[model samples]
Target: MSSRTTDGRSAATTAALLAGPIVMTAGMAATPWESENEITAYQAALAASPDQTQIAAVLLFFGYALMGLAFLSVLRRAGGAPRALRIPAATLAFCGATMLPGLVVVDFYDLALIQSLPAEQAAAVGERAGDYGLQPVMQVPAVAGLLLGGILVMLCAWRSGLVGGWAPALVAAGLVASFAVFSGVTMVAGASCSVVAYGGIALRLRSARIPSSPPAARPATA
Candidate 1:
């Protein structure tokens, strides 16, 4: 494809990636409860409005899938880095992205179990699910993937001059801040920074002029 067409594709990918965060935010908003005690409340709410929980779970699943796409696109845009940096970043990002959808699945299962089982059985199953299910197994690693992968991507972008100015720094800072407070607000802050960083990358790639092939090296003097 022509350079112009390639740039357009990259810009479109970035735009689609932007939707990931928005969808995730919407999923969060649609969530029925904030705490374990609230699970009972959620059960009550679900009885009155049967579809809401399912809809929220589906939305979360799509959000995570979009996040995976956005992450992979960012890695593609950061291509040409040293293998040492590139490999780990890609691996970690991939692990996180792959596991994200699983989280939503586990959550939905938990909701369904609660809805379908007796209270005693539901509680027992929930505890076992947390202790034995794939969700807990993958949660920490997925978190590590996003955090480490994001840091590596920022570093690679800075090194390659693919992204300059304050955007990379802001992205890195936001990622760090998410861990610092470990709150919902911090999560939103981190996601916002990511959006800004990716948006900046999209604009840069869209506007960049394609470089022609370098002239052949000169012969050495006798």
Candidate 2:
């Protein structure tokens, strides 16, 4: 593609990536319920307005999807890294991004069940799902993917100078804080960091000139 076309694509990808955090922030704002693993609380929140819960879940799913695409865009832009580093970074980020949708889907299903089923029945089903290890099984990997992948991507971005040093560092720190605390404040902080990093990159892409030559392809070694 021409440099102009490449620049345009980068700009578009950045926008998509930026949308993830924005949507996530909005979803959280709309649903003020704590994200703790409190079935009773969650059910009560969903019971208050099933439609709103569903809408929030949908928004979260799209946000995650867009974030994944943004990670891919960053990976593409990270041509400065060695092939070895880039490959693993891309792989981890890709796996994490792909897993996000599954996590959102499972969460949405649980929310839907809470919305549709009677309180006692929903609680029973939700408890059973947890007892069966379904919740942790799905959640652990998804969270790991998102966290680990994001960390690696941020590191790559830092090393590649795709974004400012402080942005990725702040994002990484926010991620760590969110994981450690699991509170609304920490979550919002992390999401805000993501918004800044990705939004900054997007703005850069819009103004910067695209490189003339594509990144060199790594050669196969026997």
Candidate 3:
């Protein structure tokens, strides 16, 4: 039983070892999607080509699903900080749910684009916003999910006792402030925080092979 438990721990450590790089690559994938032309092209292609929507949706779903798994793993290995994991896991689940609504809305957007040549042009312009007919409704959940996710991420970083602790916390706090300001700063700050939190954890884990430091050698007793 002891050996089996040790082996399980070893495997989890190894898997966590690889998680950082995998998420780093996902960060790279996300950057391209951020570009205006890329988003516009992504939506336009989905509008013009039936296969594109399927491919894009599959890829996006896979990426997010993988991220969810990674976060869950982090939570599991939190070494007594279960609260840290629960908040993040719940937030991520909510984000995943929010994205599902877009699945239906994007199809509608594409159909609308195909209805007319000039209308397709309008759709391409609107693609930058990625606003389907349902976006107004979708935005509420999306924003809420994102803000909550940021808060959870900040909590994780705080619990981890990593460097630049204030950054994540500040970013999360700034997002909440922006919500009241109505300046769209929430979106910008929240996304920035996600990237920082993602990349920061990857870098930290890479540098610190052992998730927790070794116990200090005890002083000689009298």
TM-scores of all candidate predictions against the true structure: 0.70, 0.78, 0.47
| Model 2 per-residue lDDT tens digits across residues 1-222 | 787888677667767768777887666555546556588777777677667777777887777767677778878788876777777777766766677666666556767787688888988887787786466665666667666677677677767877778766887888888779877677777777878877877776665765567899999999
TM-score of 3: 0.47
Question: Residue by residue across 3-114, what tens digits does model 1's lDDT show?
Answer: 7888777667767657766676566556564323444544555545457777777877887667777667666767667778878877887777777677776666666776
Say which candidate scores most in TM-score. Answer: 2
For model 2 the local lDDT of residue 161 reads: 77
lDDT of 3 by residue, 60-148 (tens): 44444454544554454444445646665466546753553344445545545554546557556566465567666756655455455
* Model 2 weakest lDDT span, ten residues long: 28-37
* Alpha-carbon deviation at 79 in model 2, angstroms: 1.9
Query: How much does candidate 1 score in TM-score?
Result: 0.70
Looking at model 1, the pairs that clash are none
| Candidate 2 accuracy as TM-score | 0.78
Candidate 2 displacement at residue 194 in angstroms: 0.4
Per candidate, the number of residue pairs that clash is 0, 0, 0
Error of 1 at 182 (Å): 4.7
